[model samples]
Target: MIYAILTEAQNKQEKQPDMADTVDSSIAVAGLKAAIRVASHGSFLRAAISMGVSQSQLSRRVAGLESRLGQKLFHRHGRGVALTDFGQRIMPRVQSLIAELEAFDALVSDTRAQLSGDVTVGVIPLVSRHLASSLVRRLQSTHPGIRLRMLEAYSGQVEEWLSSGRVDIGVFNRYGGARPVYADPLMRGQVSVIGTPDHPLFRQKDIPFNVLQAIPIAMPARPNSLTDHILGAAANHGISLNIALEAGTSSLIQEAMLASGLLTLSPAGTYVKAISNNQLTARHLCSPSVQQTTWIATSRQHPLTAASRAVEKFIKEILYTSTQ
Candidate 1:
C-alpha cells in the first residue's frame, strides 16, 4: 500500500509542473473582496473600517486567501499596505468581477422598479373608505403591473399590523396629540358629531363639547384611542358623555346613531360620502374641539419594496387631495 501511495504521489507531481501555482477550490468571495478593498484603500486599517470589520479580521482573511493561492497579495508596513507584484497583476480581474456583480445587482433592481409584485397596506376605516377606491384607480392607471392587498381596521389594529410586519404601509389616525415620532403627518381633520340629517345639531355649523352631555351618543367601545380621547376631553371639561351604546366598529355606531337618533363621534373623512349624500350630517365638535391627524407610516420590521413604495405614493396623493 505504501509503494502504491508513493507511485501515485510521483505521478501527481509529474503531471503538475508547479503545485504552488494551483489555487485551492475553497477560496471565498469575501476574501477576494477584502483583498480588493485593502488594495483600493492602500491601508489595512482604512479598509477594515470601511468594511465594518476589525483590522485583524481583515488581515486574517487576506492571509487565508494568500495561502489558498500560494502567493502573498499585500506588503504590510507601518505606513500602510501595498499590493504585491502578483496582486497588481490580478487585481484588475478581481475588480472586473466586482463590477459585474454590481451590474447584475442593478439589473435586478431595475426589474423590481417595474413595480410588478404584491404590496400590502394597513389602513384605518376612516381613510380606507375613500382611499381604497382612489388608490386602486390610481395604481391601476399608472402602476398597472402591481398587485395590491389592503387590510382595513381601526387605528390600534393597523398599528399592530405595521409593527408585526403584517403590512408594508400603514395609514391611521392619531387623536388630539402631536404626531408620533416615526410617522409622517398627512393631514389634520376635525372630529365631528355625526347623526342623521334631521338632527337639530345640523342647524349649527359646529357644536360645543359640553353639548355632548345632554345628547345620547353611540361610540366605539373602550380600549380605543379615539374613544379614550373623547372620554378624557369630556372629563377635563366637566362634561359627562351620555355614551348610550358602545359598539366595536364605526359602521355599527353609525347604524345605532341612525336608528336610535344617537350621535356618534367621528373624523370628517369617515362620513364624507354619507354627508354628501344627505344621509348623515357632521358638525365639528368645538369649544375645545377634538382633532385627529392622519399619518402615513412604514414599519421598521418590514422594509418597503418597489411595489410597496409605489402604492404608498398613490395613497399619499389620494389622501392629500382629500385635505385640499
Candidate 2:
C-alpha cells in the first residue's frame, strides 16, 4: 500500500522482507474466526456444523493459522482437541478482536440489518440440558448468521438477566402478573418422578404424590419453582414428603439418584431421550398432575436487535415443536 510516489525503484524490492507478514495479515481474519469457533465449541466438527461450513474448510483455516504462527495451536487426542499453550496465550486477544469486529459491523450496519449479531440467552438448567444441542442445530441450520451465547441458570437468575438487560432472551415460567418482560408461551412440560426402569413404580400409569415417601425420592431444595409446587401440593394432601436429599440443581438431583440408587423428581422433558435409551423413567403424578408453562421472553425495558428477534422466533418454534 502506498500513499505517494516512491523516490526510487529500489523501494519496491525492499518490500520483499515484509511480503510474508503482509500475506499472514491478509489470511489472519478468516483463520482467527475459524480458530475461535473451534475453541468455543471444543470440537472442530461441531464448530463447522454450527458455522454452516465444511469441516475440511475449517480445518484448513486453522492449519494455515498455525503455519503462519509457526506453532501448534491445538493438541489432538481421542476425545477431542484442546488449545495448546501458545493458543491459550493468544485466545483472549483473539476473542477481544472478534468482539470488536462484531461491534464495528453492528455500528456500520445501523438500521439496515444483515441479521448478523450475537445474542446472550438465559435458559433454565433442565431446559438447557435437554434441548441445547438441538436448539443450536436449529439455529445453525435456519439462521446461520446469528451467533448464540447461552447462559444456563435457575428461573430466578434467568428472570433477573432479562430484567436487567444482561441477556437478550430467556426461557422462563409464563404466569405472573405485571411482569417486567414480554413473554410468549412456549409449551407446558410435566413435573415428574424420575426413576430407573427396574423400579416397581414404573408399572403404575400415574403415580400419586402420596407414594413419594414410599420410595424415598429426592426433591429439589426449597426456593425453587418445582419444590414449591410439590410442597404446596403435599401440604394440601395432608402428606409430608420424607425428603432423602435436598439437591441444589436438577442435574445434581438426577446424579444423586443415579449414584445412590435413589429416586428423584424432575421435569418430564429433561430425560426424554434417556427414557427411550432405558437410562431413566419420568412418571407424572396423578393426584396433582403438575406441569410448568414455559415462555420465550425478552425484556420490555431492553429493545431487541434484529438478530435477537430472529433468535427469539427460532427459540419459540423449536421449543413448542419439540415438546409435541
Best candidate according to TM-score: 1
Model 1 lDDT on a 0 to 1 scale: 0.78
Model 2: how far is 219 from its true place, Å? Answer: 2.5
lDDT of each: 0.78, 0.72
Once superposed on the true structure, which residue ranges of model 2 sit more than 4 Å away at CA? 1-111, 129-131, 138-145, 174-181
Off by over 4 Å in 1: 1-108, 111-113
Kindly report which residue pairs in candidate 1 clash with one another: none
**Candidate 2, residues 144-234: lDDT per residue as tens digits?**
7888899986676788888788999999753223232246677776677788877888798878888875567777666666677777778
**Alpha-carbon deviation at 258 in model 1, angstroms:** 1.5
Model 1: lDDT of residue 15: 50
Please give the lDDT score at residue 208 for candidate 2: 87
Cα error, candidate 1, residue 208 (Å) = 1.0
lDDT of 1 by residue, 1-324 (tens): 212322333344335534432233223456778899899889988888766679999988888878767888989788898988999988888777656654554456656456688888998888886888898888888879898889887887888888898999998888987556457788887899899989887898889998778688887777677888899889999998888898877788777877878898888667677778888888889999988988998876855776776787788888888779
